[model samples]
Target: MNEYELKVFDEIEDWKRKITRRSGMMNRVSKKAQEKINEFIPEKVHELMTESIKGMVKATLFGSQLTTNRKQAIGLSLEERDELVRIKISSFQKTAIIEGAGTGAGGILLGLADFPLLLTIKMKFLFEAAAIYGFDTKEYEERLFLLHVFQLAFSSDEIRRNTLAVIENWEQRKKELVEMDWRKFQQEYRDYIDFVKMLQLVPGIGAFVGAYANNNLLKTLGETAMNAYRLRILQKAQ
Candidate 1:
């Protein structure tokens, strides 16, 4: 490997270990507490939420012609392509922060609207990032890869590990993958963010919470997407 590629390889190896590490006691405790809170909500409410998020995600996947059509770059080193991706992530982060604050300050109605808006922003960023990394998001397998990257960012420790394995072995494993369960996808993402996002509906502090939460979420997704693509590209380098 070249110097730059070696550095990225080391970084990605560290990230791989971090994502698959066992959850600490505090993480387990927090997850249980969140589960308890989720139990109070009705099953019907949960179903409706899953459906809503699924619809938004499906719309973004099939309807939006935003980033999926971008021709993958050529004649750039991995380092140069990653620089372009970092710029894209930064732009999307700012857009997410603005959307979060606006919806949050507008009270419950607009706060509710934040879900679909933020999902779209994140997916669009992924598509653009994939293109920058030389992956064509219009292809089914590439889009599936993006979803696994998303799950890796927002799932529990065990699920995260499993998803990472899928991403790591995508070329071999994808033939076995028929379809992603949208309901499970929706549920996992929602469970991951339910508490903080709920605070975005509060009367007084919603704007601050929303902005902070959304900003951080985008950052997490950006990091995950970068590392996920690195796994593939660096493997090819080997």
Candidate 2:
């Protein structure tokens, strides 16, 4: 395999390590939660969490494979790598929001939609928001920044460490990229341009924000909000 191909493999390996470690952490958290629940509640709650995590692992694996394949197909250079990541991250983030808003059977568009369409929406929403809020520079900038961050897949320390390790492996393989120089990859150019064109045909926004928001927000706000959200959803079903 060429340097590019090697880089992709290395990245995959790192992803595996990160996923394993994170999964372990999640497992521990789930175990502790189950213990607490079992203390008060009569029956075992193991199956629900166990099943959810199983599904999460499956989803994680699928995402990793898709990303690896795309990276290999495009033979992305350092520049293209950044661009691809930006596009994917932003689109992923927007999809998360839609998911949180409750899309039901449709799933989030970014996760399930055609890639071209998903890419298109991210760009369109960004520009349209810019035009509408041009004079209000602060808000526009904030919105734009949030959009970019949403695209950033792993921002939290735990997730970031794993992501960085994966990127570092790629950096080692793609020596020409100057070791983690994602900035030079010009991800914004491809991500934004593609998003704009796609918007005319299909529209969307940030999934990462909601993920991060849910994690961070709930962390600070405590479990009450989560329980409330859960109870509400359950109530709706009943």
Candidate 3:
């Protein structure tokens, strides 16, 4: 690896340590509280949320395939690919900010609309990032890898660790996995973002909160995707 690649490798190592570390007290407490809250939410509501997210995600997966550039980038150095991905991430972040602000300004009805819209934006960005990194999103396993990347970004610490393991050994692991656990996927994703997203439904400051939250969310996902791909590329070189 060159100097830039070595720096990225160091960043990936640090990210791995941070992600796999145990959650702090406040995070654990918050997670427990969220679980308790989930118990009281009627099963029907849970089912509705699960199905809604599942449907939207599945739709986005297929839809993004049709729209994303199928050809992987060729002959680019890791530095060049990373630069392109950073540009793509910035573009998607701006799009998410605009969508969040617009929907949030409209209050409850539009706030509700933001859920599916943001999901679409995030998934589309992942697809594009895959192409930039020279990964083929057309393959089912690669698409599934994108979903693992998503989970690693938004899930609780425990789930994040497990997902990271899958990502780390994806070439071997992908052979054993046939499908995703949609139920677990939706629940973890929903729980992770529910609080901030709920704040985006408030009447007065919804727009600002929505924009800020979406910006941070995209930033997190972008970082996670970049490192995840970097790990794969660097590991293969080894």
lDDT of each: 0.86, 0.34, 0.91
1-238 per-residue lDDT for model 1 (tens digits)? 9899989999999998988888788767767887787789899988897777777887897754453647656777899998988888889889999999999999999998998899988888888888888887777888888888888998888889889988999889999998777767886787788778889999888999889999999999999999999889988878
Please give each candidate's TM-score: 0.91, 0.28, 0.95
Decide which is better by lDDT, 2 or 3.
3
Task: Point out the worst 10-residue segment of candidate 3 by lDDT.
Answer: 68-77
The top-ranked prediction according to lDDT is: 3
Q: 57 in model 2: Cα distance from truth in Å?
A: 3.1
How would you encode candidate 3's per-residue C-alpha lDDT over 118-155 as one tens digit per residue?
A: 99999999999999888998788999999999999999
- Candidate rank order under TM-score: 3, 1, 2
Which whole-number lDDT from 0 to 100 does residue 153 have in model 1?
A: 93
- Looking at candidate 1, the ten consecutive residues that score lowest on lDDT are 63-72
Q: Candidates 1 and 2: which is better by TM-score?
A: 1
Best of the two (1, 3) by lDDT: 3
The C-alpha stretches of model 3 lying farther than 4 A from their native spots are 24-26, 42-45
Off by over 4 Å in 2: 1-43, 59-68, 71-74, 103-238
CA displacement after TM-score superposition, residue 52 of candidate 3 (Å): 2.5
